[model samples]
Target: MPTKPTREQWLRHVLSSATLTDAIKVTATELFLEMRANLHVSVPRALLARRLGRSERQVSRRIQVLKESGFLDVIETGWKGRTAVYVGMFKSRGSDAQRVTVSSTLCEAPKRHPLEKPVPVVAGHRVTPWASRHITIGHLRHGVCRNVSTDADASMLEHVPSLDGHAWRSRTAARLTFSARSAWPLLRDTHARLAAHLHLRLRPVAAHHSTAARKRTTP
Candidate 1:
């Protein structure tokens, strides 16, 4: 049997396959959950798009991401005139027959996720705290989440099958943070100017991550 994925794995897969930037994944998931609730049969892509005001290509792409991430399963295939209809799998199946037959017992309301917290915004819209290795900024529709990484922060990508409008992105964004140790060089070299540039206070961060002294020797 294949090893079951942990919460972390699922989280990463959802983010990656959704082709969603950190800020948009939660919105995407919520949209998906809302759409999944009233399904009798998985309908045509064009219809789904019209309901959400999203382009048909966008819905199709997200579906492909969901499928590759194991969040959605394809059971049978059909046609609405010329549009293809796919049976969606939200859970495990025993046979090909099970895939086509969706069960109400299997479909459940999406859980209320608590991770969608608000972050400070610039002009009342852009997310804030700037950027740092220890913390990441992501948004969903209007919500955002921020977390700290004590050590070096790492980001990796997962391969998801491509869909007509679905996308998973692996591009890394470079950001500098004014609060972290790695930022000492910029902080020290031009403390006054950098502070003004970033609108940061000139005061020091007490304790300053503990590793501040040790890394002085590091490049």
Candidate 2:
């Protein structure tokens, strides 16, 4: 018979695979691991909040984050006075047919990540944050950019499976605020600023260089 994964193994998988960076996520995952192997656990929000030293709302948000990131599954939702049931899950698959389905969010993640790499402009709109801010400022000055609430924080890219080819991004919400006259100049300035910022940030410092040199020069 196949044995269930130990807590340590499950935690290692979570850390390595999800690259989980938040304390809440870590704590929530730990709680999930304390449950039965089959993940037939019923944890209440208030109880979880108390255990983690967080507000119920915070715990709720953390649970949502876990679900969205493919760390937890909702086996059943609470209705009336019932508590919800959840199953602990990770991004791995077993050879057997009774494995948890991989999350679509993770599958779509790499292809559509907002900051995967620097994108200057897409569909005549500034994609970089600095450039987008500059465009917003320009519009603010002219009172032209309305519907500010509808602004998009990320670019939606077309999914292309080929490695040799590149994918095109859709027209971002920033384009909605743009006029033909100000569009080109705004994009140009934003791209220039972003490039300079990247250059400075990515430039090797003396300490890093010295460390590398020491490693190479050491006997």
For model 1, what is the alpha-carbon lDDT of residue 97?
30
lDDT of 1: 0.41
Clashing pairs in 2: none
Residue 52 CA displacement from its true place in model 2, Å: 1.9
Model 2 deviation from native, Cα RMSD in Å:
32.1
- What does candidate 1's lDDT look like per residue over 47-140, in tens digits? 6677667786666665565454345555565455664433333333322232211122124456787866788666633223333322222221
- Candidate 1: pairs in clash: 19-167, 19-168, 23-139, 23-140, 57-165, 61-165, 61-166, 134-149
Model 2, residue 73: displacement in angstroms? 0.9
Candidates' RMSD to native: 30.7, 32.1
Clashes, model 2: 0
Which number leads on TM-score?
Answer: 2
In candidate 1 the C-alpha lDDT for residue 154 amounts to: 23
Candidate 2, 43: how far from true, in Å? 1.2
